[model samples]
Target chain A: MKKYLMKGNEAIAEAAIQAGCRFYFGYPITPSTEIIEYMARKMQQVGGTFLQAESEIAAIYMVFGASGSGKRVMTASSSTGISLKQEGLSFLAANELPAVIVNIMRTGPGLGGLGATQADYFQATKGGGHGDYRLIVLAPNSVQEMTDLIMDGFDLADIYRNPVMILADGILGQMMEPVIFKEPEKIEIDKSWATTGANGRKRNIITSYNLHNEAGEEKALYLEQKYKGIKEQEQRWEEYHMEDAEYVFVAYGTSARIVKGAVDQLRKEGNKVGLIRPITLWPFPEKAFIPLLNRIKGYMVVEMSAGQMVEDVKLNVNGAAPVAFYSRQGGITPQPEEIIEKFNNSYHKGGEQ
Target chain B: MGETIFSKTKGLTNTPFHYCPGCTHGIIHRILAEVLEELAILQDTIGVAPVGCAGFIEKYINVDFQGGAHGRAPAVATGIKRALPDKVVFTYQGDGDMASIGTAEAIHAAARGEKFTTIFVNNGIYGMTGGQMAPTSLIGQKTSTSPYGRDSSQSGYPLDFPLLISQIPGAAYVASVSVDTPQNVIKAKKAIKKAFEIQMKGIGFTMVSVLSTCPTNWGMSPIQSIKWLQENMKNYYKLGELKTPEMLNQ
Candidate 1:
């Protein structure tokens, strides 16, 4: 492994190139522009394509075209740009094309701010686009994880014939950390379904339109079963100091990094606290909490949003342990002290029976 | 036994068209299929169909086809062509899909000189959506949306996309032809063939705007629609090669 100090956005670009991604289309937006700029400088050197599209809408559709041609393709954008891509994302899902999208999320219901926020948690996990579909969502906490998760994202997309999203916040996009660049791993992929000019086979048709009722229903059933398989096979999470913990902090992405610090400080103060960091946001590792539900008295979900991932935590807890939320909105992250203060006030004050 | 003079082109599938009786989409599809067959690149060609009456072209054209969102065919074609430069790539779009909602995409695709062929079909109104006034609808034309006969004071005049695209230096081949008569149909086929040939040579963007008719949308018979198109569309849109690489050389 070759180690280097790299920013999160640059690490992601390098990882994508190592993962065999050769086509990149994007529009420039703050906190996420570094990835595109890096691709612009490096893609041509690697014999790949990097296009600054007219808009986010065109960029995503361009990805759709490139992915249909059976190439490893990717695109990156920020919150408002991601919203513009919802239509193209829906088309990619409906056509069952494999691609990767990265969202370096900013604070927003609209264009809220350029700072970091996890407000897109609900949007990422709950299928931001129209239609009954799900993108395999991966949340990365550090620069290294950002690199590793992108490599994993491409594989998962091809394995399931679905789109995968790497959901990171502005903080992760801007932060720098030491990372070890792994050599490109050799992976075998079947291109039997791709539209490579038919090549003496039946002509390939990549379309989302199912005019008849039966055909549309069948596509829906196939996608539902695929989601179920993903849920069963791909739930990933990390546990810290969980053995004798009475209170657990449930968080993901940058919030999980903050929660780790809070858990360590609370443990030094003789509080039985631990952290549950979810790496895959869509799968929502419910089984991790199932066995420890009785021993854990309460779970606190720390997020940069008002309260989004808390819903998933509550759904997973299901009354086995009370779930509370501590959050800061509009790009303001909750400090470790703020999380600890909220936890002590809530759990020790008879907040959870 | 007599020699068979006419037959269905091998480039087309066995699927019958679902277009209206007087609509010219079927004619356009047949000519495009014949061109691909004549070029002997049907097996190595990928076509993009846009969101309009021609959206179901994949069913008729026997080649790899990708369905594009409304007004995004140029972007999609750019992707496919850029990814597989060795293969022939093209997009078939209607006026509303290209000239109206997708104006920016088409222009920028030309500006980038994306090496692909675009077969732009221009009728007066939006046929698939029940004959709404399109961006290319004539000044006095009346449709469902323009019941008062398209007033230039409110709705803008028709947009001549071929003329607009001809101005771009990146555009290698640009032509506007009609399908109203046998002579004009021959001219349309010639232009379509030239556009594909330019793409085969890896030249810059090429486009051919084919003037067609929609009898159902115009509330006229098939014969009436042809005559109406020739008389009105010809006056506004000049039928000839608007630009070519040869012009650039001279």
Candidate 2:
């Protein structure tokens, strides 16, 4: 396998092409602008379409149009730009259209500065749009995972007939690393429900609107069942140093890397600390926590936001294990020493609580 | 079987339209359906349906349709056209949908010269939502929201949307027509057919703005509304083929 040194954003673009995504609709925005720029130059060569929409709002609607046409489509944006896409995202999910969306993190809540921040954890996992829906969120910490997860993201989108999101921060987006491009696996799914010209058949109409209230409620129940199946089947995570560990740090994305560094240092002091890093942030690694809930003394969630993922941690833990949270807000990324110091203070060093 | 000289277009579905008694949306829908049948493009066509009264157009058209958000049909049509260049695509949008809420999507799609057609039904007031003021509502026109007659200072003047669309360099063909009289209906059909034909040629963006009436929303009887539109709407909106590819090149 040839190794290509590339940034996470570039890897996402190339990986999507390899995954057979022929349509990309996006607007230029920070931390992920390279994804669209790369597509603009490379798409026509691959026999695909690339359009820089007038606004993020237009780009996502463009995603709606292409996806409805039975093609694999994608769009990428950062914090606020993703916010502009929420309305279209709701329409896509309600209509059950398959598309991939990537949100590279930036400090936000009205033009927060350009350093990396995991502040959008709640917005990404929870439906940011005005509907009861969930985006299949994939969090990639490194450039290689960015390539792997984006390829898998498109597959998951088609398999489930819903939008899948690649959720990462600026640290992973811009940072370069050597990545091996595996031969792309072709996953074929049925697209008979798609709105392609309805040529020799009954006209297919794609809409999220249900005229009657009962029909809307019935559709909501159907979606709930699909989500239940996803939760049962798609919980993914990485367990590090689980054997004989007394305490664990629960984290993901950039925060997970910082927690790992803290875990390695704390183990040297015989602290018996481990890490549970979630790869899918929505159908969160609840299975990883359930088996250890009775045995582990406490779980501390480290995030770059002010306690967003910690809510999920507490919900999953459900009082079996004491859950604590430490975070840095507004683009401040904490170092491993900070996590270690906070852990020692929170658990009193020996899981005695 | 007796020989038939006239028949309904196969381009329309069996589903009956639910438009109000005096609404001109049915006329526009009929002419649009006729254009598709005449061009032999019904089987290879896709439509983007706008919100408001026309939002339900997906049910009535025989071709495939995608329903857009409040005013995003043009953006949606751009996506469909770009993805399937061999297929003919168009958007049927209302005044409130295309002009008031979806102004950016319309202007930019035309500016980019996206290869598609737009049938903008300019009904002056918000029809589906029960008579609210629209960007196309004329000065001193009374609606439920603008009960005191649309004040120019408060509501701004009526927007001549076709004039704006025709000015865009990417727009290959643009026309503003009325459906009041029988002769004018014939002329409107010609413009509608020409707009779709331009799309088949893979020319730039094309649009035909049809001045429509809403009797229920205008608080008039069906006959009174037709007379009111002829006297009032025709006076304000210029009716003709405003721009053509020929004009653009010259």
Candidate 3:
């Protein structure tokens, strides 16, 4: 492993290249644009493909075409751009095409500010595109995981033959941190089932087609089974100081970074505070929090949206303990001190415990 | 008179097409397939079929095919070509995909001069969706939605894609052709082949606008639709190669 200081967006782009991504297509949107720019410059040197698409709609379709041909492809966009990509994303999901999409989230009900926001939690974790489909979402809290999960993202995407998302925020995209690029893993290109030319073989068909009612039902059943397998096989989380801790600080991506800082500060004041940061958002590590229910007094969910993820926390905790929400939206990121204050207040009030 | 009825260029395919009767899409598809076969690049080519009538083009064309959203075929083709430059890429698009929702993608693809080809079929009306006035619909042309002839004063004027595309510096070739007659069909094939040749040489964007017949939309018989295209649409979208790298070679 080689240690280098890098921004989260740059790290994700670099790791993608190292992990054998051959195409990057995206539109210019704040917080996510840097990732596109980085790939645009780097992909050429690596003999990969890079394009600044006409719009997010075009960008995602470009990804579909490249991925359809069985090459590793990717795209990066923010909330508004991602919204444009929903049409193509639905197509990608339906076709079971392997692709990587990075959403450096910004605040938005519509065209909100360019600052970090987790308001896209529903859009990213649930089915944002169309049809009954899902994207495997990875939520990284630090520069390390940002670099690490992109490699994992590509692998998971290929394994499932599905679109995988790195759901980050502006803070992660913009903030500079120490990152280590692990040794490049060599991967073999598999074209046995790929839609390369129809040379001397039966033409390989890549489509999301349900010609009849029975076929549609079967396709839906197959997809549900795949999702269930992913839930069992791919749940990842980081439990920090949860043992004998007073409150569980539940967060992911950039919010988790601030929560970590808050937990450190609160510990200096002799308060027992810890964190449970989710690395994979879609296959949420519910089992990690389930064990903590007996020991933890309460759960405080911190994100950049208005209680988008708090619902997940409540469901996981199962009313064993109360869950409170602390949010910062419309592009403003909650500071470490503000989160600490809320935690201290919650602990003192003892309503959640 | 002893010449082969089908062009020597088309790839081998066993199944019949699912297109509507008297549709010109089959002719256009055959022209593209023939061009690919003649260039000896059918084995190295990928085609993106857009939404609307051509959504099932994969079944007809023997080459590798994929589908994109209504107007985003060019964007998807751009991605595929850029990803694998050695592979020839093209998009088969209709007026709806090229002019309406996908206008942003289409113009940008040409402007950027992406090294690929676009086969644009301008049939004056959106045929698959009953009859809607397309961006390319002629002024005073009537459609189901436009009960009265299309009034540019109310609805926007018909967009001239070939003229607009010719203005982009990145485009290496731009042309407008029609499939109204056998002679015109031959000219359209040449235009299509030239576009493919430009891509193989790594030249930037090339587009061919094919003026086609829409019998159902025009409220006419198949032959009358052909006659209408020959008499009316040809004046609006004149045929011929506007620009080509071959000119530079000459």
Candidate 4:
């Protein structure tokens, strides 16, 4: 367990190598390009694959091809590039291909600038592509966690035989922090369900083409059952000083880090503040937030996007407390001090509900 | 490795291939199989077949076959090759799959010099989708899509795939050959073999364009289909090596 100072992107690539990922296909995009570059340099050393695909579309399909062959495969892209990958992602999900997709998110309705933002929350957590499928979304708030979760993402992907996304932000990708790169535990490769080019036994076919209506419906139902099981097994969250606190700040990823710092400072100032950091965005810890709702006085939903996760929080809270949102758009990361100020402002002003 | 490799391509199980009588897909498929045999890499090879008439090539090829989206065989091949460099990878694509819908995928694969071979079949018309005008359709070639004969004022002239591929620095070997005659077919087989050899040496992207016969679209007999390919298509798409690995290293 040697600790190495690494940027979030580099840590993820290193973690992937440790996790037995031998295939990486990606196209360079802002913020996330470093992830691809890191893998590109490291893959050669490990006899792994590194391909800079023509586009995000091409890159993801390569992910499809490799993953279908029962290999640990992955691809990374930013917001706009990820948007282009929606169709392929849906196909991957529908086919139940075990692969990882890292989205170092940036702001975008279209091509948003290269800055940190959590604008992809809905897209990541709520089936970004046109399909009734849920990708296991892991939100990492630190470089250390980013590395750890990338390994976990691969395991989860293999376990569920589905795509797992590390819905990270540009801040996380660029920021450098000390990380202990642990040698990954040995895991057996499973290809019982994979389409490894039809080697005699039952002709392994990997496809999402369910032309029969009944067959498609049945597959969709089975996927729903898997999602339900995942919801029970994989929901994760962190509670910061919520035991006796009134105002609970809800956030995740970089926003959670900012909100955590804010809560730490506000608690010292004698204001009752706490943070709820969601690690798994898809199986959002709605139940964990339930115990806090009755104890908390007010809710400040701090995010880099405009009220996306805030809506989810409000819906979960269900009027247990009034919810206030503090957000910034187009790649701006909300500062710790700024988030603290919002918390203080709302706490002092009293109820507007 | 010394064992002769049989042709991997076959007609669909329980159904004959939908190709026109004497369509060159069967010929090109055999050439690819022959090359894979000569290289002794068929057992470890993965072939990506693109959408079009040849989209169901996965059914035909006995080796590991993965179907790719139209024009995306190259990209799919890139992935499979990159993931498993020890395994030989190739793509069998039709003109529509190689030229029109997938130009970007093809160009980028070549530009990146991905270590894979692409066997491109050009028959001047889209055979799968009821004989539509394809990218390689000659100027004024009539099809369902270009019923009035392709008017250059509206439709672009036929694309020269070998000429285009030659410009790509990443490409180690590029040649255009025809399956219209026995001699030309033999030459085509040699070209396919050479392309695979370049990939085996890690010589980057290799592509061979086979001018094929499409009797149903050309409205010709099997013999006339061959004759038409020789007379008209061959003149437009001359059979020769556009780029060789030796030329590239120099």
Candidate 5:
């Protein structure tokens, strides 16, 4: 294994190549441009293809086409660029294609500046595109995790025959950290369904629901079964100081890293504050809340956005324990003291339900 | 044994076409499938079907096919051809799909010299979505959207797509032909075959536009629709091989 100090965006490119991805199509946007540039430079040396598409819509459809051709393909974009990609994403999902997409998120309802924010939790975890589909969204808190999860993303996409998204933030995208590359586990996926050509056997037709197509209802039912299997199988998270705690802070990605600072300082001051860092944002690791709900006093959801993940926390927690939310907006990270103050202001001390 | 004079090409599946009666799209599809079978690239070909009346092309085509978003068939074809360079790839698009909504995808694919063939069908009206004004609709044509007949100032003149594509330096072959009569259908088939042949030789983008008819949308009988395309559309969009690889060599 070789170690290199690389930006989060650049690490994503290198990791995807190591995972046997040979096709990349993308349009440049801030916090995600390095991913494309890195791919362009490395793809040439790796006997791969890299194309800067005319638009985000073109890039994703190219991904759709390439994936159908039995190749591991990828595309990266920011919040606004990802918005432009929604139509193709819907098509990718409807067609049940496997491709890795990255959204190095920037703050936005629309063009929310070139700064880091976790405002896209709803878009990433819930459905951004118009359809009843779920993207296996992985939120990486550090550059190392970002590199490792991208490799995992490709495998999961191929296994499930669905799209996987790396829901990263601009801060981690631009930050530099040392990452060690490891050999990827070889996974043999049955690509007999791909649209290579009709050389020997019967032809393969890749399509979705159409007006004349009468099998759309059955297709939707089949997809629901696959989603149900995924939810039961993949739920990932990290619990810090969770063995003995009264109040838990639920966060993910950059927001979780910030919340960790508060967890440590609050523990030094004799406060039982813990952290639950969700990795798989779509599956959401609701099981992490179950064991803590009986003994814990309450839960506090910390985020860089207003209050998105908190609702999910409350939904899972039910009425067992109260849930409080704390946040900063517009590319702001609330300090540890501020997080502690919000915690103190919201809930009382002493591990009591 | 009796000698058969005519048979459906093996390049198409047993699935029947869903196009309306008196529409020339059926003729164009048969011509393309015949070309694919004649070239013996049917098994190696991958087609990207455009959104429109051609959206169900996958059901009818025998070779591998991928459905495309509206106006994005060329881009989809680009992806397939680049991924598997040895495989033959093509796109089938309508005037509303290629000339109007998908102009950027079509033009950029040609500009980038993507190695693929495109079958462009020009019916002078939007057929699938009911009779509406298209980019190829004539200056005075009365469509559903253009009820008062198209005013050049309001709806703009018919866009000549092959002429526009031929001007691009990356395009190696472009032809505007028609299937109005039996003789012209043969000529149109020849043009389609040439376009696919150019793609096999690793030439840049190649396209053949077949002037077609839609009697249902044009509010005319099938014979009148053919006459209208020959008299009105033939004058607006000239017929010929607008560009060829030989011309590019020159």
Candidate 6:
């Protein structure tokens, strides 16, 4: 393993290259453009292709084409840019194409701001675009996790033939941290499903259009089963100081980082506060909170959005304990001290059940 | 038994085309299939099919195909060709799909000089969507959308895509041909073959814009559609090569 102090976006790009990703298609968007820039500088040297597409719409389709051809491919965009990619993302999901998409999320409903935000939790976890589809969403709190999750993201994408999203935010994307990259794993994937020229086999066609009712139903059922399998097998999370805690904080990505700080400070003050950070935002790791529901008095959901993920936490808790939410929206992030205050107020007042 | 004089190209599948009667997309598909067969690259070619009537080309073509969203085939072809440079990559796009919603993708692909072939079918109307007015629809032409005829004051003039593509510095070959006649069909095949050959040579972006008849959309008989294309489209989209590698060398 080699250790280097790298920016979060740069580390993700390098990890993708190390993971055998050979094609990158992107259009410049703030907070995530560094990943594209890094790929442009390094992909060519590694005998890969990095293309700056005309638009985010075009970039994602390029990824669709490359991934359909059995090459590991990726793309990066910020909030509005990612929103622009939803159409192609839907197509990618329907085609069952494996691709890595990094959304270094910024605040948005529409061109909101360039600062960090977790507003896209709903968009990422739920189907962002048209149709009944889901992306395997991975949230990384640190630059190191950014590298690790991206490598895992590609593996999981290929294994399930689904799009995997590394859902970070501007903070994690811009922050510099020491990252250790292990030797690239050599992966041999079966090309039988790929559309890489017919040569000695039946012609391979990749498309999302299912005109017949029965065919569409079968496809949807197959995808539903696959998603269920993923939920059963791949839900990931990290528990910090949760063994004997009364109040637990649920967060992911940059909010998790800040929540950890708050938890540490509250523990030093003799408060029984802990954190449950979700790594896989899609499968949600609800099981992590299920067993702890009886032990914990309440769950404090901290986010960079308007309490989007709190709903999920509430569902997981399921009346076993109250779930309270505190959020800072439009690119403003709450500090550790602010979170502590919010927790104290909520914990003392009894969270909403 | 006597030797057969003619047979279908092996590059095409047994699946019958879904194109409407009198539509020219089948002719264009046949020409492309013949070219791929003649070059013996059917086993190594990957085609990008655009959304529209020709979106189902993958079903009829024997080579591997990636279906692209409406107007995004050029970008899709760029990705495929860039990822697998050893494979022959091409895109089959309609005029509405290419010149209208996909204008930026087409222009940028040509400007980047991505090594691929594009077979652009300009039928002057949207065939699959019930004869909507296309970006290539002629002035004063009437369609489902332009019920009172295409007024230049409202929708503007038709787009000359080959002329636009040829102007890009990255494009190595650009041609405008038609399938309106047997001789023109031969010339169109030659142009398609040249575009594929240039892609094989890695000579940068190449495109062949074939002026085709949309009898169903144009509200004309199959014979009248051909004659109308011969007279009207010929006046706007001039036939023959617009740019070639030799021109770039000069």
On residues A1-353, what C-alpha lDDT tens digit does candidate 2 reach at each position? 99999988999999999989999999999988899999998999999999999999899999999998889999999999999999998988988889999999889899887788999988889999998998899998899999999888998999999899999999899999999877777777998877777778888899776579999899999999999898999989998888888998999999999888999999998899889999999888889988888799888999998789889888888998788778887888989998888898889855422
Instruction: State how far residue A12 of model 5 sits from its true place (Å).
Output: 0.4
Expressed as tens digits, the lDDT of each residue in A1-353 for candidate 4 is: 68899999989998999999999999998888888998889999998888777788899889988887779998899988999888788878887888999999987888778888988999988988887999999999999999889999999999888899999988899999999876666667577765444445544445454347999889989999999999999999988988788888889988888788888888898988778888999888887887776677788898898779988899898999888889887877788888776766676866332
The estimated TM-scores of all candidates read 0.98, 0.98, 0.92, 0.85, 0.97, 0.97
Regions of model 5 farther than 4 Å from truth: A212-214, A349-353
**Index of the highest-DockQ prediction:** 1
How does residue A41 of candidate 5 score in lDDT?
97
Compared with the true structure, all predictions reach lDDT values of 0.91, 0.90, 0.84, 0.83, 0.90, 0.91
Clashing pairs in 2: none
| Predicted chain A of candidate 1: TM-score | 0.98
Give Cα distance to truth, residue A350, candidate 2, Å.
9.4
Model 3, B79-163: lDDT tens digits are 7787668888888888887878788888898888888899999998988788888888988999987889899889988888877
Model 5, residue B170: what's the lDDT?
89
Q: Which stretches of candidate 6 lie over 4 Å from their true place?
A: A184-188, A350-353
Higher lDDT: candidate 1 or 4? 1
Model 4, stretches more than 4 Å misplaced?
A192-203, A209-215, A245-247, A265-273, A290-298, A318-321, A335-353, B1-15, B18-27, B30-42, B127-133, B142-149, B181-190, B213-231, B244-250
Model 4 agreement with the true structure over B1-250: per-residue lDDT tens digits: 6886754433223335656678888878767776676666656777787888887766555577666466777877777776667777888888898899889989999998989889988998889878999989998888998999999899878889778988889999999988777788899889988888889889889999988888887898999888887779878986799999888877
Q: lDDT per residue, candidate 2, B67-172, as tens digits?
A: 8699999988888888889999999999999998999999999999999999999989998889999999999999988999999989889999999999999999
Which pairs in model 5 have colliding backbones? none
In TM-score terms, candidate 3 sits at 0.92
At residue A259, candidate 4 shows an lDDT of 84
